[model samples]
Target: MPITYDSQKRIFKLDTKTSTYALLVYRENYLVHLYYGAKLPDDNLASLMYRGRFDSLSPYNPKVEDELFSPDINPLEYSTNGAGDFRISACSVRGENGDTVTDLRYVSHRILPGKPKLPGLPATFAGEDEAQTLELETVDSVTGVRAFLLYTVFEEYGVITRSVRFENRGSAPVVLERAYSACVDFPGMDFDMVHLYGRWAKENSTARHPLQHGIQSIQSKRGMAGPNHNPFVALARNGCTEETGEAYGFNLIYSGNFAIDIETDTRGCSRLLMGINPTDFRWKLSPEESFTTPEAVLVYSDAGMGGMSRTFHKFYLNHLMRSEWAKKKRPLLINSWEAAYFDFDDDKLAAFAGEAQKLGIEMLVMDDGWFGNRCDDHRALGDWAVNEQKLKGGLQSLIQRVNALGVKFGIWYEPEMINPDSDLYRAHPDWAVCARGRDKSISRYQCVLDMTREDVRDNIFRQMYDVISKNNIEYIKWDCNRHISEAASLQLPPDRQGEFFHRYVLGVYDLMDRITTAFPHILLENCSSGGGRFDAGMLYYSPQIWASDNTDAIERLTIQFGASLCYPIASLGAHVSANPRTSLKTRGNVAMCGTFGYELDPVKLTEEERALVRRQVADYHKYYDLIRYGDFYRLTSPTDNPFFCEWEFVSEDKTEALTTLVVMRQPEHVFHIQYLRGLDPDRLYREEETGEVYSGALLMHAGLNLSCVSWESPDGDSLVRHFTAV
Candidate 1:
């Protein structure tokens, strides 16, 4: 069993394959954390709890009788405001009588065979045989507010998912000022904080800093989980490396305004908190109403960041993503957005598809101008009708033409946006999210649709469902181009106005659920102006996401590297684009790390380029499984070395490996040695092209000597090496 309870000690221990988390009920009531690290034997681990005598000098509840009962300094399982803990709280509520203090004592707990679903939220789920859940119920004595701390342990994956549910059991209405999903209290502060941070075109850039006094956090307040900051934080030991030492990760399974906060108090203790951002967020819970926070995935890796990443990848692939195509090989697609943006007709699209078919591309996605007066980015966003003038025979004809050429067809839709000139907006102007008397702010020449309104969401979903059902389209690139501005919904009452952001996210999930359920075969890819909405919540519906708009091969090295810290490479939508004018081979090699595709006019390529495209498509098929399901290792980072970047994917069984080395600038030397990982030291591996055999230990320790002849010559600045065990 993953979870075990010691009733005599009043202790709960959650164990995974590589880690153990133990907590105990101290003083017969208060829940306190004991240990979280490498796996420990299920014996008397209660001594791991730090019981300092000086902790009594910190803040305490005067009403409590115990002398060493300071909630401020103790390692609390779940800390609440007004109970004496002042650093950062998990839940805060104002009672009907204006009382803010909450003293929650453990009431009961139940150990279940499987994980329970989080209501209206995306969470990791598992079969009864694969996981176990522990639910601990605690109630505030004064207000009768009940809190349930739920923990689901995926023993094999070394992951524990946590969530909190609050129910008002008292007579009066309670306003929830702040509610976080999970909180962890550490006994020491000898760690480094690592997070992903970036802007629109450059999403998920890695940043790390040392732990310091006071609070430091990464947050998003732009309504959706904006591209600026991702909702993931990791604490690594001082000397932790990619392949060694301890690392703890927390990722939220939500795509709204989120915050991940870490604080080091005066006593050198650290606290980590993650959940919905309290800024511009509030929920009113009536006596019988309950609110469930999103799930926060926690991973402990004594084997370092690589192990942590592999754990997350495996867990998300098997549990979080629920599409038939989750484990299937993705198609090598050609998108028309960058090639002929708003200027292609039916014949042009058919010609593009014809070229793609000849080069072995499996799909041709018609992006942005196939529907309604959408010649440019300025108009016709909410309108979902086919433009007969451009298509000449409608969407069905285009799909048929593309399909006849041995390529599937995909179409793009911005269902959450509304252009002022669009018919849908002109008819129901109030459907656009805007303050009652304020001028609607425009982003990308469009306003966001008020998805918080059920009618608005239903209308949009119906339009999309009708189009997808009537046509033979196999894929949909759902895009949300802008963030919410003037977040006002006419349908919501004044007191509930603060609920608009979260409710809007729920509406998005609802629409996504409906469409995905109705058309389960479509390959849905989510995009938010190129990686804006690239979050785990969106991954629950879409198997892949358009990684970014910046297709520059050199820039993408960093972008993709940073994103891989939490997200699996298979979920990133990357394409060989004709921007930055890099070598075609380099472009193809850079994109091979993700869901490989193209965003260029295939017909415009020379015969040599066409041959390279054929080889790239063939390579995609050859290594699709390995790249999709392999253990990824970051050998070198572009942020650390401006001249080059290197990474590799090794199969789980250590039989095969594929490594890519990209040179952004000419190196001063003629050759460089690249060390590899995740290989069997006793085996001899033969290089695919050179046929040269070397021991795995030699390649991993002494490194492979890679000549820069091809990189320096006109061939390309990128090299991909494949090795197989002999």
Candidate 2:
């Protein structure tokens, strides 16, 4: 068993393959965090939580009257507001008298064989033999509010998931001001924090800083998980690197307003909290009604940042993704966005399909202009009907024509947005989110639909189902082009306005469930103005996301590299775009690092360039398995070495590996040696291109120097190599 209780020490210990987490119950009430890190042989960890008397600080309980037992200094497992501890709390609640204060004490607990499902949310799932769950119940004696703390330990992955469910057992209703999912306390503050932050065209850029005295956090209040900040954070030791020191990672399984906070106290102790943001969030819990927070995943690695990353990758691939197409080989595709945008007609699309078939591209995705009057971005949103003026013979006819050319067909949609110029918006202006007596704000000439209303979802679903059911569409590119503004829902009362954001996210999950259930074969790829809503929550419905709108090969080196730190390679939708600055070969090398595709017009390319496309398609098919399902390793970081970028993917059985290196323009002649990772030390391997054989130990330790760039073009170059164990 992965979970066990020590009756003598009053401790609950959870263990995985390489890590252990333990908590202590003091005086049969307070829950204290003891330790979490490398595995321990026994559960004798009560000595880790030392108690000391603080002058002028009140004791935890009057009956005990022990000055050394103050709650202010203890490492509370689930800290609450106004409970003698001044640090940031995990939860806060207001009673019927409008006073906000809570003190929840340990009550009882149970251990289950497997993980339980969270209603109306996307969470990791596992079989009975793969996982074990622990449910600990705590209650506020003053208000009869019970909070169920849930933890599930995956024995093989060295991962733990945490969540909370708040139940109002009192007669009067209680308003929950804050309900963060999980909290952890570390002894010292000598650590560096890492997070991803960027704007629209530059998503998932890595940023790291040392822990400060006050709070350091990353959050998103833009309705969706905006491109400005991702819903993830990591803490590493002072001198941590890609393959050294200790690191811990935290991620949330949600796509709404969220916050990841790390606070260093005056005593130099650190605490980390993660869940829905408390700002503009309040949930009213009626008697006997419970509200559950989204699940958060925690990973600990003693082998440093890369170790933490690989653990997350394996966990998400095995547990988070629910679609059948998750592990399957994705088809090579050509999208119409960069080629023609909204000006493409059915005849023009058929030309794209025809060219795609010549190069062996498997799918042709017609983007943005087939429905309503959507020739441009200014109008026709929320109108799902096809416009014959653009397609000439309707969507089905265009799809049939493309399919006849031996290519699959795909279409784009923005179902959660409305344009005032469309019929759907004009019929019911209130369907869009707007504050009372305030001017409505619009972005990209669009208004967000109030997903909190069931009628609104029903209307959008009918229109979508009509087209999807009639056409033989194999893919759907769902997009949201703007952030939400003036987020007031007319369907909710004034006191419940705080509940709008959460309810809106739930509504989206509901609609996704309906669509995916009805059409199980369609390949859905989500894009929020390109990578804005790219997170674990969206991955539940879609296998891949458009990483960014900037498809330049050089720029994507950082974008795709940073994203691979936490996301798997198969989840990034990379494309060879029409960037005239870079060479065709270089573009293909970078795009092949992810879900390989093309975003340019094949007919416009020169004859020589088209020949390169055929070779690239062949390479994609040859190396698909090694790239998609292999263990990733960061060899040389683009941030550390601005002159180049290098990474690798190794097979799980240590028999094969693929490595990619992109060299940028340098100031002078420079020679760099790239070391390979994740191979058997004694095994001999042969490089496919050079036919040179070397032991894995020599390759990883001695490495090979790359200094042949002076003969190449000034525009830079890229190289990819394959190795097989001999």
Candidate 3:
């Protein structure tokens, strides 16, 4: 069993394959954190706690004078606000007395065979034999507020997930000021804070800095998990690298506003708190009401950054993603977003599909402007009815024509947005999210639909289902072009206004669930102005997400690399766009590292470019399984080496590997070596292109020389090689 309780010592230990997390019930009530690191034997860990006589400045518990017990110095399992200990609180609740003083004492706990599903939330699921869960119940006596702290350990993956559920057991209401999902206290502050930070087109850029004395954090206040800050943070011990040292990763399985707080106290002790951002968040729990938080994942890797990333990738693929398409081979799609972008009509689309089919593209996705008065981004967003004027016939006709060309058909929809000029908006203006008696703030000339309202979701779903059910569409590119501005919902009362953000997210999940349940065969791909909402929550419904709108090959090298730290490459929607900054081959090479596809007009490509597209498509099909299911390794990062980048994917059985190297434009020099990973050392491998055979020990240790990949190459600065074990 991964979870065990030492009854006599009053200790609970949660163990994974590689790490052990232990906590103690101090004095039979207060829960205290003991240790969380490399695996440890089953024993009483209460000795790890410190207790010493302090000066008058320190407040010790009067009931335990001999022990000199002070809450400020001890590592609390769940810190509370207005308590004697005050660094950063994991939770805060205000009762009828209007006081935020909350001290929860441990009540009881339960050990379960498997992880429990979080209601109306996306969480990792596992079988009884794969994982175990621990539910530690605590409560505040004054307010009658009870909290259930949840911890699930994946025995095989070596991953741990945490969450919290708060119940109002008293007669009156209690307003939850702040509620964090998980908190961990580390004794030393010798670590580096690493997180992903970017904006708009440059999403998920790696940013690392040493932990400061005071609080250091990253958060998202925008409605969605905006591109400015990702809902993830990592602590790496000093001198940690991709291949060495200890590292800890924390990520929330949510797509809304979130915050990850890291605080280092005066004694050099560090604490991390992660959950939904409390900026504009509050939940009033009436008697008998309960609120469950989103799940948070913790990954510990003593083998370094690479080890941490690989574990995250494996865990999410097996547990987090619920779609049947999660492990399946994705079609090589050609999206019309950049090709025609609401300009081309039926004939133009048919011609484009013909060219795509000729080059072996599997799918042709018709993007915006195929609906009511939707020629551009300014109008017809909420209208899902097909525009017969653009198709000459209808969406079904276009699908028939595309399918006749031996290619699958896909369509795009933005159902959660409304334009002022649309018929739906004019009929139900109150469905838009806005404050009462105030003009609505708009982005991209669109207002967000009040998803918290069931009527609004039903209306949009009816329209979308009508079109999808009638057509032979195999895929749907769901998109949200803007974040919420005037977040107040018309259906919600003022006292319950703070519930809009969370309820809105729940509404999204509801709609997605309905669609997937109705049409299980449809391949759904989510997009929020490109990568703004790329989090674990979105992955539950959609197997892939549009990584970013910036498809520039050189920029994608960095963007994809940074995202690869926590997300699997199979989930990244990368396309070969008409980004003139790099060669066509380089663009294809970079895009192939993700869910490979094209966004440029096939008809516009020259004969030579068309031939190259054919080969890229062939490679995409040939390496489909290896790229999607293989272990990924980052040999050289574009962020570290500005002039070059290299990454690889090795099969699970260590039989085959594919590696790509890109030398940046106007390179200073081509002196570089790429060290590969995840291969059998004694096995001999043969490179496909050169037919050169070498032992894995020599290839991985000595690495491949890249002086030949100069700027003068006929295909530009890119090289992709495949190796098969012999």
Q: Model 3 over residues 1-726: C-alpha lDDT tens digits?
A: 889999999999999889999999888388999999889985768877663444566556766544556787788899998878778999999998999999998999999988899999989999988899999999999999999999999988879999999999999999998899999999889999999989889999999899889999898888889889999888999999987899999999998889999999877889999998999999999999999999999999998888898899889999988888897767789999899888989899999999999999989999988999998889988888989998998888888999999999999999789999899999999999998989998889999999999999999889989998998988999999888887898888899999889889999989998998899989999998888888999988998999999999988888899888899889999999998988999999999989989998998999999899989989998999898889999988888976778899999999999999887754666466778888899999999999999889988999887666554554237889999999
- Whole-model alpha-carbon lDDT for candidate 3: 0.89
lDDT per residue, candidate 1, 602-719, as tens digits? 8899999999999999999999999999999989888887666899999989999999988777666667779999999999999999999999999999998776543464423888
Regions more than 4 Å wrong, model 1 = 54-57, 61-65, 707-716
lDDT of 2 by residue, 238-352 (tens): 9989998899999999999999999998778899999999988999888999999999999999888999989988888889888776897777999999999888899999999
What C-alpha RMSD separates each model from the true structure? 1.6, 1.3, 1.5
Sorted on TM-score, best first, the list reads 2, 3, 1
TM-score of 2: 0.98
Candidate 3 segments whose C-alpha is farther than 4 A from its true place? 51-55, 65-68, 711-716
The number of clashing residue pairs in each candidate reads: 0, 0, 0
* Lowest lDDT 10-residue stretch of candidate 3: 707-716
How good is model 1 by TM-score? 0.98
